[model samples]
Target: MGRYQCHLLCRWFFTQSLCSVIVQQRKTIDYSAKQNLLSYATESSLDHLGYMTDTPRLEAQSALTTFEFRLSTVLTGAYTIPAGTQITTGNNVIFQTDVLTEIPPGSLSGTVSGHALVPGVSGNGFLPGQINALITPLPYVASVSNLTESNSGADQEDDDNYAERIQLSPEKLSTAGPEDSYKYWTRTANQNIKDVNVYTPAAGTVEIRCLLKNGDIPSDELLEQIGNVLSATNIRPFTDHVIPKKPDKVDYDISIKYWISTDDKSRATLIQSEVNKALEEYKLWQRSVMGRDINPDEIISRFKNAGAKRLEITSPVFTVISEIQAARERNIECTYEGLEDG
Candidate 1:
């Protein structure tokens, strides 16, 4: 009887020990099944989908700007700044000349296109005077500086963005006459674009309004680049007139006062910090897309989720935004109204 009881106990303990491992294995199998679907796929699975759809992820882009080369004195002969002459901003970020440039005899300087060595947003946003250090020294070359702000640098497409593009790749099979086709091509031009609004206001006219990732109005440079892409003979319909422009911005402000529950007064400071964080997140969600309405109700929900017991939003009443316009936040004021009875 004792030996039978010991065997039974050992069997029970072994089964119990295997339960957790069995559950984990089941979870892994379920997750692998989920990745087979496009919506739930990530990383390598998403990349595989992109490959099947013939839409590869967009790669990081180098920043392009203008660099001017100066001489100590006007020389009798033209001074040539060879292509690939590297320049830096004293920091590690560097730019190279895109083409060979010449300072004509009697001319003090000449400008050439500059391309960033690093390909990503990190190489962007340098002001004109920021890139003055020459990595390659030349005879009589007094200085080298960017003539304009560094622009057109973009990061590689993230998984979510790439997935969206893959979803839209079917539209590319058709001519650019359809709105979705134009949108797919526009997104393919730059990975940083957030939203696209296509409108045919008149016969043969295709007006495209682009909104950047962070509610930044599209720069003229970006608009021109998209325009060039859409203007290609094979891409644009013969009757289509493509005009790329920035979406009109509808400015709005936020002002909110919130109170914490007195029952939870011990966490008042932590809740206040969380409420502030929620407000900024709300602002980002509000402006990141085109045609998103300004809704104080969203603010109220976000604040409440952050442990705000009550909120009084004075600004940002619900406003309808047109498809061709984006909401922009001009100002924000948030006040903590102290603990109150819940």
Candidate 2:
């Protein structure tokens, strides 16, 4: 009683109205049929690529800088020679050679932050009587590439590991059609023609418009039609027998929009029913087995995991939080005030 404040009413009313609109829009909006296809995820592209489905990968851009330096008086520190020391080509011409008892020679070194030099003699010896200095830039800075950084390509190996781990099974594939089926017979009997059934993974999206605003939730038959269209395309997995999952649990991602109108609580039921109907049809979208028998348990298990079977909602008024939780059973997976955990 203490928590049931007046301000809660306004917030509650607003939330309900907003929920109603979101659900309604989801029920009515047609995303699967939209043709403005600029880009798509690999899953979506499976439809166009057929059984030869391709997966997406990451790529990197290359960035490298080219650096250069010249051994000259202005760049290197200046050193004057005795104007007449014809240092021979192979020997003294090189800097830091076996020199006289006391002649000052020039030198060079590389720095990480400063301009680097290629490994080479900077300048050479004295030319007596010439009044010219041979600036032997002893060691110009070395280019970054020249240094042995010794990277074992750990990043490359990691990327390759990911690629190897990604299972690249085709989204669309064709095996021999059912035994004695026309597709099977025709392809098997004829060598000239290939058994390529133009396969496309189904693309399904729903727009929900509030039924209360429209006077009533759609009829069961109309809802059934929606289900049919959603599941008509191939993609949904089907199995002949139930497969046991080792972990006994699964992870999932889901989004929901709903409109709440107290004018008729019936609308919520109607929409939920519609969703169930659609899902039932989707379950039937198994690949054609032809003459081969299929496993029933596998099909059932797959159906459960493939579609979103639960509905959840939250309350704007915190006062009735417990009541909303009570309205939905734990098994039913309903939330009244919190967002779904990713």
Candidate 3:
């Protein structure tokens, strides 16, 4: 009986000591977290560190579009369209004129620069004819409509992106037009840009390809914005020609068949859910970075870890992605071949 009691006491003491060691290790990890690395630093720590780099988090920007005001008939004199003329898309998004403009007596319409009243991405993607409803009425103004698609609306920068820019801030100081310098400045143009590829296509020509979040291609307006940033007198080298373009996208498909062991039949439903989620995560990981190779091995590993007993992935062979190209998924097909005996 005494031996059994001692055994119990020893187990209890060991458990308590292990717990204390774990607590101490955790405390040390928290205290010694790397503040300089983007992956290890907390958001608050990154914000505080950004001051040293002069990289403040990017704020949301209003969408810019052109608004055209039409007259029912040619007026006898030039009709002035005042600034602050409110126009709506018939939805919640509103746009207002940026400056005072006049429609000449012989002209049937006049166009003025305008921006969305609300900032951020919500005001973007309106079609050319979408903003047709005039909120602030003016005399003899027959109609108002946007002449171009709304664009340039961007959300505020997230913590990870802000941290990345802070890390890349040193590259912005280069005057000789290095690749990293172009990348650093291009990213500063908009918060929506996900990946940037910079290379010299010719001796004096610099080509920049940018990809947006979720592998969306950069719009013309965004490319223009990036061009403007890189073309600034201080940013661009006198001998270099900078051109911003879209990344060349390599397309691939995914088709997978998997089976679960019969012994684990009860957990088949749960494992199937996990497999689907893993597939989605894999797709995102594959396209999140520029020049990420399309590897079936990565898919196999993720699927197997997600409780897939055995799987066959047929479509995505190992393809090397070029530095100026991105991989985009075209189709996805996942099939469960039912349970197989172990």
RMSD of each: 3.2, 32.0, 5.3
Q: In candidate 1, what are the lDDT values of residues 1-342, reduced to their tens digit?
A: 699999999999999999999999999999999888878989888888899989988899887788888899989999999999999998899899977989999999999887789899887889988999998979999988998888778988888888888889998888749989999999887888878889989999999998777767776657777998888887889989999988888999888888999998999999999998998899889888888888899998899899999988899899999888889888889999899994
Candidate 1 regions off by >4 Å?
66-85, 97-113, 135-144
The TM-score ranking, best first, is 1, 3, 2
TM-score of each: 0.84, 0.14, 0.78
- In order of lDDT, best first, we have 3, 1, 2
- In model 3, the Cα lDDT at residue 294 comes to 90
> Where is model 2 poorest over a 10-residue stretch in terms of lDDT?
240-249
Clashes of each: 0, 43, 0
lDDT, residue 341, model 2:
30
- Candidate 2, residues 250-339: lDDT per residue as tens digits? 112222233334443445466445545543442233111111122333333432343333333231111221100111111222222222
Candidate 3 ranges beyond 4 A from true positions: 1-44, 64-85, 97-114, 125-129, 136-152
Instruction: Return whichever of 1 and 2 wins on lDDT.
Output: 1
